[model samples]
Target: MTGLLRAEWTKFRTVRGWVLGMVLAALIIVLLGVFTAANNYSSCEGPDGDDCPAVPLGPDGSAVNDRFSFAHQVLDGDGEVTVRVASLTGTITYPPPDHDKIVPGVVPWAKAGIMIKESVRQGSAYAAMMVTGGHGTRLQHNFDGDAAGSPGASWLRLTRAGDTITGAESADGVRWTTVGTVRLAGLPPIVRVGLFAASPCDLTVTQGDLGGTIGKCRLARAVAAFDHVSLAGNPWTHDDVGAMRGAPALSQGAFRESGDTFTVSGSGDIGPYGLEGGQPVERTLSGAYTGLIVVIVVAVMFITAEYRRGMIRTTLLASPRRGRVLVAKALVLGAVTFVTALIAALVAVPLCRRILRGNGNYLLPVSTATELRVVLGTAALLAVAAVLALAVGALFRRSAAAVITAITVIVLPHVLATASVLPVELSQWLLRLTPAAGFAIQQSVPEYPQVTGHYVPQMGYYPLPPWGGFGVLCGYAALALGLAVVQLRRRDA
Candidate 1:
């Protein structure tokens, strides 16, 4: 083990470029931290009538109705922007007494989108859904960014099949991901959705000119394109309620009512929903996961680069033992990932907490376990990548091709699993087993009902549970190491 470590150390130290690579990675991580801090601090709002517009976001900016309360304002073209919603103090009544009998109640939904065309100018928009008195719930979809084709490309969809409400997203007008789901309260008597928008600040403008700026944004002009806008599920009416009332008990279970509570129940429960009810910072933490992903990629490339140079043979010849070499490579790779992940989380956590604090109810200080999982799990992910790359590099002894193939095999499975929307049984199996699917741990929310996707032995079917998924990744590493060992013993240096 000592010889193996020393040899691995010698190989890493002998390469000036590799030493510099670690430094460069650290520098990039520090730059990101600086950027996060600068962005958050400059966008801070004051106690009274701050420059930042405060409004709750919906799918798009929709007008509020009797059952819901909403307000919105556009900031400058670009800056830190946020919107929020709070249940207002009134209850609206619907005419249909048995609206519960129809599809139960109205499913209120909302959308928010912003437009950033030119460098200096930008605008924010929102939309909401409100139903006359009937038992229904809100299916709020957040489309806050200015990306996508906008008007059409960036919108939310809420559809109901039987008693289930499915929320989906569309990049173009075609494909979609079932982003989320919710069950409405028992035959809701009424439902309402809210809309909001916070435009970005004009970074080019002087501070003195900021207070005088106000823009006339028309909803009608922006809303005209919504002709294609439609709602699925049961759009119950007053007449249909009589037939639905006192109907046979719901096949799933009874809906419990409370004062605007968010709970998961029924057979269709998809584990837990990640509520965006916190301050701006928490949302930022959730979104910046892409950064961690980038670091993982870099780590993989670092180890694989050696194989391209045919330096790995020298590495193996010095160490002789494959397992120890793999372990040392993993330790270095994990160190790189762990440091990057910690820095990202540390900077993101505080900034996110500050933005989300007080204004919109957000989970602040972040959970210790969650933070540990993010940073340590990220290290583990990179470690696995390093193992796979080392194994591949050892076997192929060619860096570039091995790295490319490793990425294709490891990352492609997740994309395919996500895109496959049919063969419910097959999809379930793929979701748990796919390499990318394992990364879904970052989501912290299960995609479907726990029971719906569970493994079935009789039908010759199996799916990885969360921990089991980790095992699969380990198994891959083990198999690669095993093969590398065989190759090491068989091949001549």
Candidate 2:
């Protein structure tokens, strides 16, 4: 280890090209991270509030006791009672018994997930997913593969693994894979599970507008002796882990539904589109974080190019220990990228928090945990990328061609999908196979409607969960590293 460390250190120090690449990687990462984070939070993030004009008053000047229909309910004749969003405003004739104390309304605590079963024997909406809007209502995405207003087809489906529940899907089902493990949540838990989805599409969306209400979304059949259910994972967290902190609160806050004619105070939370002054729908910023990945590939090319120049051989000759040389390079790359990514995260997170503070209801209350997640996660991601680059570079001595090939393979197909050249059927399959699919981690959103054999298929927020996305990326990194090691052992310098 010591010899390897020395060799790596010497090799890295002597190579001005490597140093330049490191610096470049850091600069690009910082700029992109800060720019993207600030923009999203400033415009759309918010907390649910307790202001209602929808509740109707009674004939004797009393508040009506309406049964809770959706997620959030406004206080009427007083005591804590649930009501639909559309009913928030009206005449408060018969005020509730505890009306004074009910200053405003907020949603109660709840979580949503996808449940997989051996079979949807009853055919009761084969897969049921729970979704929450900006207003904090519980809704379900059942049997609808494509969400309303979405561009794609019925991109959702279920698959089975013998008697076990395995959610699966395909851009085209010919090549399907397991999304995640699913089952019930607690002791004597129900056989089926909850599904969740979110729509950033509504026009009236606001910080307070990005919630939903789920009246009663569930699965029909019992999941008997299931496996891999809880492990399905959340995908959106891959590219933007920080988004989780600003996610719509399931427990508190008033989620509003926005509109062109001001906002419908009584209506449920507006979707992401309804949020006031949010990123334009067309400019959703889908590619920013992915750019960082490209930069990593570029750096790898710079290093790998050295091998083609026979520079690596010279490097090894100078150092005398092949392993030491590799270790040194890895350390330098990891250290530099970690610091760079960390600084970017620190600057970007607070800037976003500050910008989002403009919204009165949705304050950016970041905790220590959120901060750690941002910094640590960024470093880890970059480190993995760097290691992969090292492996790739070492395996093929030519830098330019390898870099180009890597980038083309990793990023090109996703680009084609965007252009509509690739069908949804093919695209869904590609989503799992590509490195870009790993970006699902950055999502603050959770996917819903757990099904068998889908990519974290439980809901829209998934299709790929955070940790799972990371694991996928890690797997690629390990594979690339393993291949490089094999070549190193077999070939003569």
lDDT of 2: 0.39
TM-scores for every predicted model: 0.44, 0.48
Tens digit of per-residue lDDT, candidate 1, span 1-493? 7666665566666767655655554455445544544454334444354543333322232211111112222222212211111221111122235324322221111222211111110111121221111112222322221122222234445444333345444545467545455443231222222122211111121212322122221110001112122212222111110112232232111222233321111111111112322232224444333343444445555556666666667777767765667667766655555565556556655654555453343342234565566445544654565566557666776556666666665665544443433344555555565554444334332232211122221111225544466667767767876887776677764
Candidate 2 contains a number of clashing pairs equal to 112
Q: Which structure among the candidates has the greatest TM-score?
A: 2
Model 2 regions more than 4 Å off: 33-298, 318-324, 355-371, 413-428, 448-462
True-structure RMSD, every candidate: 19.3, 17.8
Candidate models: Cα lDDT each: 0.38, 0.39
lDDT tens digits by residue: candidate 2, 1-493: 6666665556565677666656565555545544554455423323344322222222222222111112111111112111111222211111235323322221211212232321222212222222222222222222222222111112233332322233433333245433433332221212233222112211121111222211221111110111122223222111110122333222112222223111111212111111111222112223335545655665575467566677767866767656556656666666666676666555555554444443322331223554465356656766666676667777776666567656665556446434444444555555567664554444442333322112221112224566676677678877887777667656887
